[model samples]
Target: MVREKNPNVLSVHSIIHRQALTAKTLPTKLTTQVFNLLAYLLDICYSLNLLNLNLQDGGSNTIYHRDAITTYTYKFQLWNRKIIACNYSCFPKLFGMLEEALIKQTDTTNKISNQLQHLTDEIKRYFPSLCYNDSYRLAMDPFTLTQMFYRKHCKTIAVIKTKYRSKFNIASGLRSALSSTQPRIENLCKNVQAHPSH
Candidate 1:
């Protein structure tokens, strides 16, 4: 009816909604397994949403985003280990659902362990840059580089300090160059008068 009223209107279905519809076709014997899987997935989704929100903060730059991604990658590893060990402390909703349903820890762990490991692997694969500990450390904390330089050679530290000081001086110089100020028109006129006319 809405399409009839507006011929140009677009209709779209969510991928998640489609997945839910597909899940309903599973056998009745697997109902508990299905619910357990859904609960575990929902917990993961919540955790991912928190990371998304953290990245969405307007003031954060690439360094912070990389830090967040690195942290989330580590979390995936931790979650994989916990799930393999049948420890549900990180997944409160999944734990509660399993408790309420009287489901065995072994069942949930067996079901989720491979999938969680695959997810952890995928995360590490997707973010190859996270392997460079030195770059992340330098970007997140300049002092780390300074300390390393100081340890390596005192001259290197002095050079780095000079470079940083020059950067600040350039920024301040640009600011003063752009600042609005009244020109000395009278002094200019007097100087023009004092000069011999050609």
Candidate 2:
């Protein structure tokens, strides 16, 4: 009874055990709260397929649904922040989780963007503006997120930028290319492994 009641009877790995306990006690509110909204926004945008020239009044319609974004943001504000810091020094850990959430959300957005052309058979617009808000959130860092990404990839990302990048000739380029060739590739590529085929 004394051994069971005593607080001092701890093993050598007490810190690790305590952290795991705390993490499980509190929840990781990253995906359901934040990243899922980003994914749904990307999906709606792909489905809408807004064209620049389609708007005659210099006004544009959004592919993204705003109410969902607002609702999720409200929920995050209401509950996403860590409820149990557990210790005086655990604030950094709480911040680290937030930073993880923001960074991972941006990564998920990029993956969805990369797959946009295939989704709902829509045109893929590699617009910088598409992911601007997410980029802004992730660019400001709490530092350990780089380590997290490295762990995810199991290697460092090698970004070797070229001095002279090829400018996209969009006017008679991607639309024409897609219209002319993309269908053939989709149709004839059965029993084949490569995509964007032919």
Candidate 3:
């Protein structure tokens, strides 16, 4: 009905549903292992007198540590701020270091390995895998995200400058472009309608 009223309207599903699903289906056993790790870290924090560590702040106990750029609590609040304070491009390397630390602490224990495996599985389920021949690129890298932001910012600035310089030119250009493509679009539409399978 909405599409009938606005035939040109485009519909795209929100990405939040994926996030919600990822959060909802988090494995409890993995969470427990993470809690154990956090507890161990908390004990170390106490011993090292790192009173500024706020891991115990009031919120979900579930620690969602995938990478520095993607760490959060189960309530979806950003967690591990200190861990993300490194250079922006180093964000991808932070999780590897953390995993190494975890491994060093646990001496070939199946519990830690199982937890890490579950975490890996959950990450693969939620995020785009870093595999070749994969096409689903995500804007998760800080450096890449910054570059994209600046690129769009520059484009927006250019559009604004052009609009201020000559308002009619933009509309007239679009009109001409649309007029030039109208016949091709109509022909494509006709072909699709006639074939139904095309």
Q: After superposition, how far is residue 121 of candidate 2 from its true place, in Å?
A: 5.7
What lDDT does model 2 reach?
Answer: 0.39
Q: What are the runs in model 3 whose C-alpha is more than 4 Å off?
A: 1-69, 72-110, 127-169, 172-198
lDDT of 2 by residue, 62-107 (tens): 4332323333334323322222221111124333444545533444
| Clashing residue pairs found in predicted model 3 | none
**Tens-digit lDDT string for candidate 3 (1-198):** 999999999886678987777777888556545755565445334523432233444542322222321332221221222223321112233344445445332322344344444544565567543332212123234576556655756665566557657553455543443353545676677778464574
- C-alpha lDDT (0 to 100) for residue 128 of candidate 1: 78
- List runs of model 2 lying over 4 Å from the truth: 1-104, 120-198
For each candidate, what is the lDDT?
Answer: 0.77, 0.39, 0.44
Model 2: lowest-lDDT 10 consecutive positions = 155-164
lDDT of 1 by residue, 53-113 (tens): 9999999987888788888888877887888777787889889987787757576687687
Candidate 1 segments exceeding 4 Å error: 1-29, 105-107, 131-135, 154-198
TM-score for all models, in order of appearance: 0.59, 0.17, 0.24
